[model samples]
Target: MIWQLDLIILVLVIVCAIAAINVKDLLSAAILLGAYSFLLCLLWAIMGAVDVAFTEATVGAGVSTVFCVSAVFHTTRRTTD
Candidate 1:
């Protein structure tokens, strides 16, 4: 509920989002996106949206991250970037 905490979480979320977008490695990007969603889940929980936070944690941060990492591993091509 504290404004300071909310602001910190918001900053972290923004940084993670930006880092994910900028990173060339697929695995790193996936991890960053997972961190970003988890941060959003924290923000939601702080705002008293427990259900939304749970869904974000389970689907956004959890399943999607796993899928992304698996897909990255399955790719035979390496980053040319």
Candidate 2:
């Protein structure tokens, strides 16, 4: 695995995480978190951690994101700040 590629992925993951935190919309933040998980999964795969990557894909990206969205659906989307 190329360190340059790993660095790129790390940068992307950081960016997505920050974006997810800063975004006021709950659904959008959840989606961004999913994207961050996806990039982390890719990084793990490239580092030869296939099992960990699969877990991230399924649990982090799939289940958690879905749960977040569902929770958002049941809550108000208004931004008070």
Candidate 3:
């Protein structure tokens, strides 16, 4: 494995994780988390753990991101009636 590429991806993962936490918009945070998961999946694939990578891509990036966005979409502001 190329150490340089691994380092780059690792940096991106850290950045994404921090950005997701700090982002104010829920949708943006969800997208950042999804990107973070996908980068992790790439790292797993590069390390020859294809099965783990596939699972991360499908469940972490795919399902979880979708669930977050869906939940955000269904949220509504309350009004004092």
Question: Which one wins by TM-score: 2 or 3?
Answer: 2
Q: Please give, for residues 18-72, the per-residue lDDT of candidate 2 as tens digits.
A: 9988888878888999999999999999999999999999998899999988988
The pairs that clash in candidate 1 are none
| Model 1 Cα shift for residue 20 (angstroms) | 0.2
Candidate 1 Cα outliers beyond 4 Å, as residue runs:
none
lDDT of 3 by residue, 52-72 (tens): 999999998999999988887
Give candidate 2's total backbone clashes.
0
In model 1, the worst 10-residue window by lDDT is 72-81
Residue-level lDDT tens digits of model 1 in 2-42 = 89999999999999999988887888888999999999999
Give me candidate 1's TM-score against the actual structure: 0.91
What is the RMSD, in Å, between candidate 3 and the native fold over all Cα?
4.4
lDDT of each: 0.91, 0.91, 0.89
**1 or 3, which is superior by TM-score?**
1
Candidate 2: 10-residue stretch with minimal lDDT: 72-81
lDDT order of candidates, best first? 2, 1, 3
